[model samples]
Target: MKVMVIVRATKSSEAGEMPSEQLLTEMGNFNEELSKAGIFLAAEGLHPSSNGARIRFSGKDRTVTDGPFTETKELIAGFWLWKVSSMQEAIDWVTRCPNPMTEDSDIEIRQVFEFDDFGEALTPELREQEERVQTEVAERNNNAQGIPASKDEDEIRSLAKAWSGSLESKDVDAMLTGYSEDILLYDVKPPYRLKGLEAYRANWEACLPYFPAKMKSEHRDFTVTVDGDVAFAHGLHHVVPIDEESPVGQTWLRITIGYQRTEGEWRVMHEHVSVPFDPMTEKVSYITDEVIAETI
Candidate 1:
């Protein structure tokens, strides 16, 4: 489960009083512990309400209100995003947290709703729009902060190159660096579906004998899309024999990779590799089809 841990504002927090060095150190250590436990996703503290504003809606009309809100206890001073097993688990973790404020404070834990929580109500179109908005929001935030929007795209492109390089060298351990432990892959070969890191490594080992001793990899027409911590890329790939007449010629296989940014690193969680298929021929069609490989 995912949860939002909200730290309620206190009189001192609303006054813009910064935490003492000792308190800050304690909180930092607590956060480090949370991160090491794989529970921390993000944490941030806000400036006092005096630096913020509120917008009120009345039908089509709007009203702007200045802050330093009177309800100090109701306003939030900081928050943390965490992925945990259950509400009780979140509570247990929270109990170990250092005091967020020098004075008395309150922290509220609320479960975040997953997309599946909507059941059948969230249609495909709505999910698409949601994903687009998420991407735009991340881009805009980075732009507003003077950060390059293409940073993640550059990383993903570099990762693609690194992946092909690993494949060319036939190094399963190197290739597994960017993959998740519970990775899932749908391949072009028989027993096409592979799950877990071990199965993926075995798949590579099984096919290595068929590959030429010296090989080169080519990846083309690659495109990447990122939405916050989730990203995906698709491209056409070919493994070429360096001089030996290989059994498998330079066949172009369509490849798609699903990436998740966890603990500040992007890892491939799902992958799909296949050749084009023709319904009329009822066999694997040999072509570099430009259609999208998969959807979010």
Candidate 2:
């Protein structure tokens, strides 16, 4: 259960009747205690309503209502969000809150309705949109704060990093560990779907000599989503041949790899490699601005 505690202090309470300095200090200390106890989700205080305003729109006719209106008792000056096991738990915590005004003041604690509370009224699409919004908000917050990636993300990244290391070491067996036995590797060249583990291994072995000097590969736009025993990773694989300047090596190729969780590890179950397609001709080949201009 989650609850929002709204604190309102009347103008008379703060008109030379502000909460004592001792009480103010205690409020700050109490907030700190709440944070340390891991019960505080968020908390913020707002200046008097004089600094705020409300707008009303009726049939495109706008009306502005400035604050410091005579209804201080109904105004909100501060709020604290708390998540607990039940509404009673939230009420119990709110009961311990210190007086926020010199004269007695009212602090309203209301239980916030959870998504599950909607029951049959909650649509799947609405839940998904809500989740997406929350995910975006969290990502934006992390970007703004420069926080490190989440643990699950870092774990998947570590798998890719280890796979890269194995490729650098030319450890075919270790590299193959990232693929499932039912893997289907598709490339632009012939034998597109390198079906099954044995076939994939054989094809890789045959192609090893062609890439004798080893290959340097990097992934971009990488993302992995895992659910239960299944997981997938799809990204552009940028590869460069170390020795031969052949077709794939000479030109850049983008590859998409799909993975599945075998047991507890991530394994590549499918791969699609290709380059840019000719938009006008619908052909899989490199196209540039010069080519497009010439065609036009």
Candidate 3:
């Protein structure tokens, strides 16, 4: 069962008096115990009611009241969400907690409702809807234990890192193996988009002549995301000519690539690359700080 541990506001809490260091330390220790026991879900301390508001509902009408609500005992200062076997277990855990405030405070434990508790009142359709909503929320929080991916994120990341090897070697065949026959690409150069594998190869072949015979390819601030059969990555690519005097090098050429898992293999489906330019002069700009890694 899930229960909320409500920390009832006291006179001191309502007055916005902070808890002493000793009390804070004790509460921290108690929370650590809960975490180690695998009973902790979430916890938070709220600001004083003076920074809060209340809404009253009657039929279709509503009204709002600003707080420091006078009913200090009825107000909550903070709360924790916990999952335990039963309400009694929640009570036992609460009893073991240290004093949370400078003055006496009442902690209330209220059982959170489970779908089963609604009994037949919750129809199969409503239950399905609720389950779907919960699943979505859990997935967003990375708590959806039942939802598993294809376990190819690492493989995709490996592909990204290996591309530099092909670049440094000027191995067009090796680089082509990473892309699909239907690959689409948008390069920093003209011909806005390249469609199909032939165009992809042609673009590479055209650019290879200008590339340094001996160069170092580096990718920085790279991020890869995989979802089922689809994946994407973006990063700054830096290519340096081995000859210090050579000018055929780039510092922050932005690169974005898309991947698709087909059958049992992953392939590049799309790609986009560009460099930042100054709007006024329409000239390329260099980033001095952490700018190259995070954004376009």
- Model 1 TM-score is 0.48
Q: lDDT by residue for model 3 over 72-122, one digit each (tens)?
A: 889999999986655655787798899898877799999899999999999
Residue 138, candidate 1: Cα error in Å is 6.2
CA lDDT scores, all candidates in order: 0.82, 0.68, 0.80
> Which residue pairs clash in candidate 2?
none
lDDT of 2 by residue, 148-200 (tens): 43645545656675566566556778777767788888876787577888887
Residue-wise C-alpha lDDT for candidate 1, range 149-228, written one tens digit per residue: 77687677667667666777788888888889999999888787889999999999888888888875656567789999
Worst ten-residue run, lDDT, model 2? 287-296
Show how many residue pairs clash in every candidate, following the order shown. Answer: 0, 0, 0
Which of 2 and 3 is the better model by lDDT?
3
**Which candidate leads the pack in TM-score?**
1
Every model's TM-score: 0.48, 0.47, 0.48
Q: Name the weakest run of 10 consecutive residues (lDDT summed) in model 3.
A: 287-296
**Model 1 deviation from the true structure expressed as Cα RMSD, one decimal place:** 18.0
Tell me the spans in candidate 2 whose CA falls farther than 4 Å from its real position: 12-21, 57-61, 149-296
